[model samples]
Target: MQHIVTLLIAIVIFGMIIGIHEFGHFIVAKLHKIQVNQFAIGMGPRILHFQKGETEYSLRLFPIGGFCSMEGEDESSDNPNAFEKKAIWRRMTVVLAGAIMNIILGFLLIAVLLCTSQKVPSTVIAQFAQTTDATTGETITAAESERSGLQVGDKIIAIDGSHIFSTTDLIYKLQTTDAKSFSVTVKRDGEKITIDPVTFHNDNTEGLLDFAVQGKSKNPVTVLSYAAKDTVATAKLIWMSLIELVSGKYSLQDLSGPVGTVSVIEQAASTGENVLERVQSVLNLTIFITVNVGVFNLLPIPGLDGSRFVFLLIEAVRRKPIPKEREAMVHFIGMAALFLLMILVTVQDVSRFFQ
Candidate 1:
């Protein structure tokens, strides 16, 4: 029964995220006066469909993907309202709108989490951990965090110039950065102060700043500011993760497809000490996956929105569009390769359960 519930939650989450993405394209295309032939909730054979004027809206068999099929989206068309006949700027807007919508949705969800989560941690330094002397292996009662002008009441505003809203924000920036020193900004006694070149004993395995912190009071400005920075941070994290994968820091096994993603959702939905924790777990997963979708779609890979946008960029640069047939062939081949990759990944996901 628990598994069934988890599955339903997974379906709802994915449906909302991807459906909003397709809707972005559909609405933008319609506003630009492009002829949208279909607006589909999924791919493959249509399970349920209906026509409203010229457009056929469909719920397809598969829930893994969807599309907004505008006239001349994949081919040349005689209709002036066809997508290909639109101005380059208009076409670019349509191509990029889906990812933009996903990103917007991610921020909105985070704001919801921030406003509602009672346990959301903050960057304000409630206290500092006693540092240890390296040679003596004894606690240094007076540490550099204070000696360098960091105080107990200081509210961390930024680290290395990136805005810091919560303790998670500070930790994320610190973990991802390689610098031995950072410029830290804090609010002390109602005044903003910058502590430049604050040195850290970075071991690369743990957080840089030595402090015990708590969540800020639910200040509207603070919450909204945190949400904005956290959104940008999440996007950056996704990009860095892809770079790590390409550089062999992460293996293929680290990747997840729909099956593995659902498994994660199951874990989040089930593994909480109480009802509130469980709810927070689900909300966190939703934010992560939606932001990830936005980032993934923005990658300049063939058969993806990013690649289509790139082709448009090329057209803009050359002041002439690429031949539609050749462009379509590129996307077709890319789609085939992507399908093969998905099959392999899905098999791997299933195999993990047995192992």
Candidate 2:
């Protein structure tokens, strides 16, 4: 019964995410007077559909993907309201709108998490830990950060030149980097100071995070500020992960498709002991997934909005559009390649379930 409930929740969440993304393109195209042929909530064979005005709205069989199909989107058309007839800037706007909406939704979800939280997490060091010495049985400093010139009240601003917006950035930097020591920048006494070789090593653990961060009381200003910062941080994290993947730091097995994502959502939904805790866990994961979707879609990969925008950019510079057939063929090949990759990833995900 719980598994069924979790599956239903995952479907609804995915529907909302994909629907909002397609709606962004649909609404923007309509506003620019582009003729939309169909606004779809999913892909594959249509399970339910209805014509509304000039557009055919659809709910397809597969919930893996969705689309907002504008006239002349992949081919040339004589209609004045066709997508290809639009000015380059206008077309670029339509192509990028879907990503923008996903990001906006991520931000809104982050705000929801912040509003429900008891305190907002900050980057300032709140306290250090003390551990008993094994030899003397006397209390000794355990926080490597304190001995390395970091103060309790100091607000960490950056690590190795990368700006630290919140604890999210701090934690990410510490976990991902291979460095045992780092050049840390902090705001202390209203002045920024750089501390070099701030070593963070403990006797028991390999983790670099040795000190606790202060939590601010929830208020309008703090909530809004933290929400925005966290959103940017989440997007940055996604981009960094992509970079790592391209650099061969991560393998294709690390990738997740719809099935893998559903598995993850189920795990998150079942995490906490209480209902509120479980909801918050799901919300947190949703924020990450939404922001990741927004960032990933913005990459200049063929068959994606970013690729279409790139073509429009080239068109703008050359004062001529690419041949519709050639552009369509490129997208078709890219889409085929993407579908193959998704199938491979889905197989991996299913194998993991049994293991």
Candidate 3:
């Protein structure tokens, strides 16, 4: 019964995000006077559906993803307000609405988390990984209390001379960084100080401060910011992390697929001290997965939203859509490639499960 409930909750949460994304497209298309043929929350065979006023709203059986089918997305339609008939700007809005919705939802979630009193980790370094801020990077910890290294109570004052107040800002600083080491200033135990290191503290690149923030509160906290902060930061992290794949930062051993996620779910259920913890774990897992989905979709490969947007941009520039046949072929090839890639990832996932 517990497993069943967990699965149902997962489905609802995942489905809701996908539904919101598709709904964004559906609503905007309607606003622009475009005709939406179908608005679907999921893919494959329809589990339930109804149509009203030129739009068919359907709930499909699968919970993996969803779509909004609008007329003339590919070519011009005779209808005056159909997608193809609209100006390029309107079409771009309609096309980009799904991603925008995902970002909005992420922000909404963060806001909710903040309202609940979860302390979001700001740019402050709560604690370095077993090291002090004054002498953390390249200097060993495990010895003294008066050390100046990033410890469990340091608040990051600046990154490379830029002020950082929130997790979002810290993440943005991370993405644009090409510098070998970050010159970080911190507020440690209420005293202002500067810390320099041979590297920044993250994986793909070197960080000057090798530290983790320690939250005063015990619960998982989400920090909200203006300008789609969580989505952008999360996206940047994933892309940067992927780069590490070639540099031996990530190995097959670290990769996990669907089955692996389920394992975590089950483990949380068994290990959690209480129901709230279990549920929190599930929420955290869901957020992680969805953020990954948001980012992964942006990969500029065929059959992905990123690639589709790239194509749309080309169409906008040329003032002509690509031939449907060519687009379809590209998607077909992309599907095959992705399917093979999934198989490999799944294999990696399974191997890790047994190990």
In order, what is each prediction's RMSD in angstroms?
4.2, 1.8, 6.6
Off by over 4 Å in 1: 119-121, 130-150, 154-168, 173-210
lDDT of each: 0.83, 0.90, 0.67
Can you give the lDDT of residue 10 in candidate 1?
A: 86
The stretch of ten residues in a row with the least summed lDDT in candidate 1 is 199-208
Cα lDDT of candidate 1 equals: 0.83
Candidate 2 Cα outliers beyond 4 Å, as residue runs: 132-140, 202-206
TM-score of each: 0.85, 0.95, 0.73
For candidate 1, write residues 65-172 as lDDT tens digits.
Answer: 898999998888999999999999999999999998998898888888887777456667776667578899996644446656688888888888877655556677
Find the candidate with the highest TM-score and give its number.
2
lDDT of 2 by residue, 1-355 (tens): 8889888989888888899899999999999999999999988999999999999999998887899989998887999999999898899999999999998998888888988878899999898777899899998878888899999899999999999987778889998988878999999999999999898865446457778889999988998899899989999998999999999999999998888898899899989999888899999888888788888888888888888889999999999999989988888888898999999999999998889
Question: Model 2, residue 46: displacement in angstroms?
Answer: 2.0
| Cα lDDT for residue 35, candidate 1 | 95
Considering TM-score, which of the candidate structures 2 and 3 is the better prediction for this target? Answer: 2
